[model samples]
Target chain A: MTTLHVIAHSPFGDQRLASCLRLLGADDGLLLCGDATYALKAGSEPLQMLQAANLGPRLFALAEDLQARALDGTQVIAVDYPAFVELSLHYDKVNSWL
Target chain B: MKFAIAVFSPAHAPSSRRALRFAEAVLASGHDIARLFFYQDGVHSASANIVAPQDELDVAAQWRTFITEHSLDAVVCIAAALRRGVLDDTEANRYQRPAVNLPAPWELSGLGQLHEAAQLADRLVCFGGD
Candidate 1:
């Protein structure tokens, strides 16, 4: 079954992102929120890692969080909380890395 | 849709508030909540000892009231709770502890309950972690 992996930690000091990438299925999705949104920061190693993951359209972030952090989210789909709730139903299941 | 929500952050943390809001939205949209599982530091949300400062929002109280108003099944991981000192009266008596921080509407259960809820739920949405 396809799963939506939600992460909220920093990619700089945590291993959840790397671990998630390893187990993410072909149709699975990854949603970055809170500090996890930092993964979309430009020219960062985590950005490179995410780029290599080739998540494409499946990559998403909470728009408000990105905005709060002043991080550009042009590289990924940015959704609000309402859409976040909608996405929980869009996938077969949601696995929050927390 | 049935959602099994798991909370892993402490009561004072931001994510726990987010989890509460998400659960509120889930119910507002006419969805069913399979279970509310409090693990790790999230078990503190069920504690009676949480005293929020005057300026801060009382999220723990909000969570308790929400569960009671909706008659929701709120489960706290027994292992996590015991270690974290979030004990019901039974656990308090069992452990010969004098304090009881857990109360009604919040049941202390094993981790297996989370798995069972997950099995029965359409989606398992978790909040907070290290």
Candidate 2:
């Protein structure tokens, strides 16, 4: 199944995000929201780790969350709530990392 | 539809209660729950030592009774449970603990169980901490 893992916590602070990363299957994807938007900042270690994982087009970040945190310049695609809903429909399962 | 629920918060948290309600609603609507995985602080729901006040609801007991009545596959992550002092009989004995708090219906398992649930279920919704 194509799974979409929604991470709503900060990368450095919460251990669940790391657990989510470790559980990612080959066809699985990730969606960053809430405090997780901080992880999308360019040059951040978490972003590097995501890149190293080779998630490619599967990685996404919520535009509203990033804007709320005043974050910009992310390699990951920035999607709105509607897009988020659409992504959830596209995937068979969604695992929120909180 | 087969649904899998994951709870990331403890029994004291609102998210845990919300997850339970959601699960009940799903089952009432004729859906099947493939598994319920409790990770991180959510493992507290499986512990039997919780004592709520007379007025306030006992979330742990609520989960235990509901899971028992439904014969649900409620799994508490072993790593997360051990780290948070939520132990089953096997874990309590292995760690030399005085008592086992995790209830019988709720099993202590690895993260692989969560992955398996995700793959098997049609949808996997998570209620997590803020």
Candidate 3:
């Protein structure tokens, strides 16, 4: 019954990230990719809030996206395509927040 | 496992192309595709009138052939498709449009169909939006 939520927009621009956050449940996991990787910058309050609110679910960001954005020391786990595939397989459903 | 795919970008968009590749890979990996739902600008993929230059890749055509070959259900959101001017013969007649562009095998449906597909499939994946 776990849902894998894939978010691809920046928190600063699109409301999708917020909507994703609001919809996420205790059993759901979050993966930040594309422009969303920018949210991992150090000292982002929203990012911190996301971390605090969803401790029961796993949080991840795309490593390739992070590298593209030059974002390092992200609080969320960095994952590659293989990890992405693994997550998709582990979860019962995937809800892409696009 | 059964999967339902949602495409949220136009056929010409890079993300749309990527979605095709992903779906191909999933099928090659032996997964079953329950449905391919087209939402937002992705409804363009169902338009039969789409024409590409001989040199460029005809994305819509590719989707048509693939869907036909697999006997997959490709559902385009009727509301979204109408707003975007992608219409089937029935819709065209209702609206008195000059032409109908939506082709066979790609059916116009409501969002409820997408919801049903999500519930029926083991996984629901999406491509290209936001």
Candidate 4:
């Protein structure tokens, strides 16, 4: 089953994003929200890491959080609350890295 | 699809509020919630004694209202609840605690119940931890 890895912590805090990427299945997706959106900050090491992963369209970020943190210029699929509900159902499971 | 939502955040945390909103959206979208498992600090949401400041939102109250409105099956992890001092009458008696902070509609069960819900649900979503 495909898993939607929801990460709400900052990538600088721990290895959650790295570990999620390491275990991510071929079809798995990553959704960044809350402090995790900080990873999208321009020129941040976390952004480089995400860019290197080549996630393409499989990566997502909460639009409200992105706007709150002023995280723009990234190629992430921004999801609203309704879209978040839809994405969770579209996937087989959601594993939150809390 | 059915969802088994596990909350690991405290009542005052942002994640707790987010989880509640997600649960509401899930039902509004025609999805079913198999269980609401409160673990770790999340057990505080089941505490009836919680009182938020007049200006701040009371997430615990909101959660209770939501659960009651839907007549949903909400479970607070026994171990976590005990650790956090959230107790029902049965547990208050069992442990000789001073008060019974957990009330009707919110049941206290073991982690196995969460696992069972996850087994039966199409999705297991968790919120908050640190």
Candidate 5:
């Protein structure tokens, strides 16, 4: 089995990353780090509106799906740059696990 | 499944975080990550001076941890990193910079690495916009 790490830092308004996710498949692993959560938050309004209006769950469902996968030991870690720097300093950590 | 992820976002945004989440999800699904190629603004994610606020989340650190834990092959675009002042040790010495800040677990390399990833992985997943 292969894992694809998707590093999203663009605006949620940008659907490119979402499209990539769809292409990878519905059950793929997802990690939300950095400002990507903001994008998700910002988009939540419209997504919720859509869900309430009976349009579709699209984004909401995606989030729920990703959350489920995360709880299942699929690791969806989110941290900021400083934390990343600290982790980067410890190369052994990245080399040993995934 | 073998996959490759291409990141092209600045370090402080939600898009980059989402990308990492996607990578983790991929792993959870029992897939192998071929490589992670950081390009354009994405190189800033590897910068060492990036500090997250005390209350806010630090996504870059998460990436570092993810890469380390998963043994993910992380390659930053040399041109992009250099242009953005993300200097590795060699780059720091080449430019005679006082110190090297671009941290480990991330390598400075060419776009060729991107191509290699695309060819090697079953899927080349790109995050962020053009």
Candidate 6:
């Protein structure tokens, strides 16, 4: 499954991010950071469509996604600037999955 | 998903770092990044004379290293960079300048590159001011 992390901090909000999310198939995961409420507002409708379609691992807001990952003891797929740094630091560890 | 990021803020500012970090994050997420375009004041981030205080991080160096490490296509709008005195080697010679400050791993190009990036990328993320 592909994971997309969107860092939305521009005045244009998350319109671009939302459009990308809408284009993804059901098995994709979306991780949003910074101005997430803005992403939620921009993506609400498309997210509902994906949910209704029963697409797996759809949009994940910060808190809910983190908490769920913690409860399941699983690493959540995330896209964001800081998250990229973390991944780069540990590329070798995750190379097998990639 | 494939993505592109457009940065429009001056270097050393919070917004600029935020934008760079965001681009780094997008790449880390295991998705493809088509390009990183610097427009308006954001082109200044490619300037080589950007010396930060000892206490502050060297943003220009950071961006250079990041782009080189990732082999990311980093383009600065030629018109904007020239207007702001950020010159490439060719432009510096054209203008008969003594030194060229615009660093490597960042190319100067027209807005057509930006348009091409938008067309190629599934998501074109813009950072900094409107």
Each prediction's DockQ? 0.60, 0.20, 0.34, 0.63, 0.09, 0.11
Model 3 per-residue lDDT tens digits across residues B75-94 = 99999999999999999999
* Candidate 3 chain B: 10-residue stretch with minimal lDDT: B13-22
Model 1 chain A is weakest, by summed lDDT over 10 consecutive residues, at A79-88
Error of 1 at A48 (Å): 2.4
List candidate 2 stretches off by more than 4 Å. Answer: A1-97
What is the per-residue lDDT of model 1 for residues B1-130, given as tens digits with 9 covering 90 to 100? 8999999998888788879888998988889999999999999988999999999999999999999999999999999999989999999999999999999999999999999999999888999942
TM-score, one value per model: 0.90, 0.61, 0.72, 0.93, 0.61, 0.60
Indicate whether candidate 4 or candidate 6 has the larger DockQ: 4
1 or 2, which is superior by DockQ? Answer: 1
lDDT tens readout by residue for model 2, A4-68: 99877788786766678889998998988767777766788887777788777888987766777
Q: Model 3 chain A, poorest ten-residue lDDT window? A: A48-57
On lDDT, the stronger of 2 and 6 is 2
What order do candidates take by DockQ, descending? Answer: 4, 1, 3, 2, 6, 5
User: lDDT by residue for model 1 over A73-93, one digit each (tens)?
Assistant: 889999877778888999888
**Chain B vs. true chain B: TM-score per candidate:** 0.97, 0.97, 0.95, 0.97, 0.95, 0.95
Instruction: State the TM-score of candidate 4 restricted to chain B.
Output: 0.97
Residue A72, candidate 1: C-alpha displacement in angstroms: 1.8
Q: What lDDT score is found at residue A15 in candidate 6? A: 56
lDDT of 5 by residue, A17-92 (tens): 4454545433333334333334344236523332343312112113432443342212224434333322322221
lDDT of 5 by residue, B42-95 (tens): 997777778999887788888999999988899999999988888988999999
Error of 1 at B78 (Å): 1.9
lDDT values, one for every candidate: 0.91, 0.82, 0.81, 0.90, 0.61, 0.64
True contacts kept of each: 0.63, 0.40, 0.42, 0.56, 0.09, 0.16
Task: List model 6 lDDT by residue over A1-98, tens digit each.
Answer: 34444433431443555465556554444444444323234335644543454534444444433343342212234434454444333321111000
Better of 4 and 5 by TM-score: 4
Interface root-mean-square deviation of model 5 in angstroms is: 11.9
TM-score of 6: 0.60
| Descending-lDDT candidate ranking | 1, 4, 2, 3, 6, 5
Give the local distance difference test score of model 6: 0.64
* Top-scoring candidate (DockQ): 4
lDDT of 4 by residue, B37-84 (tens): 999999998889998999999999999999999999999999999988
Q: List where candidate 4 sits over 4 angstroms from the true fold.
A: none
> Which of 1 and 3 is the better model by DockQ?
1
